[model samples]
Target: MSLPENFNGWEHLQKTYMLEYNRRVDKFFSDVQGNGDLSNVRSSLKLACRLVDGDNEATWSLRTSLFFDVIGYSRKNLSIFYGSNIDTALPVAGHPQLFLYFSQDSQAVPLNGKRLDHEKSCRLTRYACKSGQSLPAVTKANLLDIAHEIKAQFVSGGKGIIYTAGKLSVSYTDPANGFPKGTRWLVNSKSEAIELYGKLCNVIDRPFDINKMNVNTPEKDSTTQVINTTDTILGKQYKQYAYRPVANLRFRYAYVSFGGSASPIFLIDTTFRNTALIA
Candidate 1:
């Protein structure tokens, strides 16, 4: 496509870019929707960012801080989607994703005529789609579907849990196949997420009175007037109530690309009990 010789407008180009930008922002919130910890998403993104550029801590910190706001926006839109609990890390070398599950064991101790031993067992599964030509298309619309597929293939309907890229993660849920309700708890732990919503107002310099509002809906008698500009109406009463903000976000790819192959690489790690006796 060639640019129009006399075209002086950038609106068309801006619109196209905005479409992609909106898609990315939507996908990010959708994926991080559930009751899981934002920290996991933060950690995963942190590690992924590090793997991409390890020497710039300041840059990474700033970027992730911005990401924290994006996550807040996602949570605001869909408060029901419990966040993810799976442990996520930068995809291992030659791997596109990883899966993990935990199990507990108990044994009788021989010391006091009774044995009591507790142990936790964990399993790791890796899925690599970096090879082969049958690679499925990864796009904004189907991002959530792909995350669901990852859980279906690795976790099945079992207790196994897996981590994903956190894009469209809101779609990965099953009544019988997912983590417990309490497993993805947040609101209590994320004061910053809530504060970010308030920050939006202050950051934009929206001046509202602190004393004249009630979070429980202020009546006319107690309503406070807010002034945005010197000549603007000072009689306009404003009441402050907290609401979630929609995040502006960008989705990034963390996979390695090689000649001709575009599928994500897969790895599966199985755990087995060692029962062999020493001869």
Candidate 2:
């Protein structure tokens, strides 16, 4: 089916995708059951349904591709459908798509003992697709190809938490300009904000103090605002300065798992919103 030219909101779009995905899954299972391969049909059906539910429109195409791929692989590897170990065997035997999905869906713990945060597994799946690598090959390679790249890009050395791209508006108090408000340095990305923060720290003789606070609001509207305040004393005179971040810094981690073991893989990508700096 096709969407209407005036398709209104995301709710409608999501419902359409959900309906189509369910129809495809139901038909696929019915056809499989009719073929007399009734072995572990219930288990297979349950897993197949998971591909659609709880997923968004962005991953719909990839999940559809994975669904058909699983069917094709299962046909070639018939032994996976039978026996007492069918439940376990079917996922890892020759079905990389299923294995990847299970791994990405499960929770993972890093060395810090904190649950990693990030976007849905679809982000990594899309990343893998963009690299032109087959999911089966990535699975067989223990997912290192994607894992290594993700770590290089997102993870901070000695800091277990992942750093996702975010927009930040930092404004510092500048009394010399006769402005009551702080001079703002609007940065587009987290990396750029950090770089600017480092530069600010260098100019002062004493260490710049960093204070972080969580805004008290609804979870969906919650944001982390970091304040950097510095007190510099020159002879008898002292200057107190403060910088505040007005935008939200979303924190999340992505993980890849196989054989029940999960490892942090990547962070969700976010675009930086640009705001004009106030002098």
Provide the overall lDDT of each model, using Cα atoms, as 2-decimal numbers: 0.28, 0.34
Point out where model 2 deviates above 4 Å: 1-118, 123-137, 140-142, 161-253, 257-279
Over 1-279, each residue of candidate 2 has an lDDT whose tens digit, in order, gives 987998888778777876876655654444234322325543454354435456765566666666656545223212222113233432122222211111111112222222222221111222232224454234423445443433343334422232232234444332221112323334445455454334333311113323321112222322233223335566454333222223222322323322222322322211101110100
Lowest lDDT 10-residue stretch of candidate 2 = 270-279
Clashing pairs in 2: 117-252, 117-253, 118-252, 118-253
Q: What TM-score against the true fold does each predicted structure earn? A: 0.20, 0.20
In candidate 1 the C-alpha lDDT for residue 233 amounts to: 46
Write candidate 1's Cα lDDT for 31-85 as tens digits: 3333224355433443332212232556645544554464443233222322133
